[model samples]
Target: MKKRNKFKHFLYLILALAMLVYALPLISFKEGWSWASAFGVAWSLFAFLVIGAHLHYLLGVDEEKQKTLERIRAAKLREWQLKWPEDTQRRQENM
Candidate 1:
């Protein structure tokens, strides 16, 4: 991951957290605060924001791995290009 992408992801997470914090009081206080409502909010934030974001990040890692593998395979092919074949009349002479 590049520095810029990390910064952007961090900024997005911060913004989301700030928004949730700002809304917590309003949601809980509006209906006079209950344990269930608070729990629901917490669960929703974790499931949707944290888990979802991390899942997306994990998926991106696989994509990056694939690109790296492709590059490595290409390099290996280039390295072996010189020794690819030596097809000549030797096989016909033996037969």
Candidate 2:
């Protein structure tokens, strides 16, 4: 798991660098910013924020493991509690 997480992080770093290289060139630093230059910079920043957020979320999460844990919890709850129909029946009887 540690190795996999490291690999995933490395991949995200590479992607971020690639995106930066691709989009940074679109911006012009010359005096009197044109509309196109402003738009390019905004678009690049937006892309970075979105991709960074996704990578941040992905780094800490393991979907398969989370699902398995959830299933185990559900199974334990079923073992400890009355089934739905039985509980409903008991409730009706009490009323």
Candidate 3:
């Protein structure tokens, strides 16, 4: 399989593991497991997810944050211009 496919499989595996953690606590609680052990298992699962997230970011397998910020800024500027047409015209003329 290709590298990207492998990565996707890895992510899916992680997702499955995360889902398992969500279900495990409920099962453990029902099975009369001790609170301390349950908490430990949950905490370890959370740490696993945290590490997985960091690894994902390190690999840059996501959209660029700057692009999202730029889109937000552009939308805000458009909203401001719509609310204050005269201010926008004045700023444009000043340039």
Lowest summed lDDT across 10 adjacent residues in model 1 is found at 82-91
lDDT of 3 by residue, 1-95 (tens): 55677577567757767776676655445556787667868776776776577567646576577678899999998998788988888899999
The runs of at least 3 residues in candidate 3 whose Cα sits more than 4 Å from the true structure, single-residue gaps closed, are 1-32, 61-65, 71-95
> Each model's TM-score, in the order given?
0.40, 0.49, 0.34
Reference-based lDDT, each prediction: 0.67, 0.78, 0.71
Per-candidate clashes, comma-separated: 0, 0, 0
lDDT of 3 at 52: 76
Greater TM-score among 1 and 3 belongs to: 1
Candidate 2, residues 1-95, lDDT tens digits: the string is: 96787677667767877888887876787866889888888888777886776576666566777899999999999876757778789899999
User: Per-residue error at 86 for model 1, in Å?
Assistant: 11
What's the ranking of the predictions by lDDT, best on top?
2, 3, 1
Per-residue lDDT for 1-95 in model 1, tens only? 56687677667766666766666665554676599777867765774676458456644776788899999999998867754543335555677
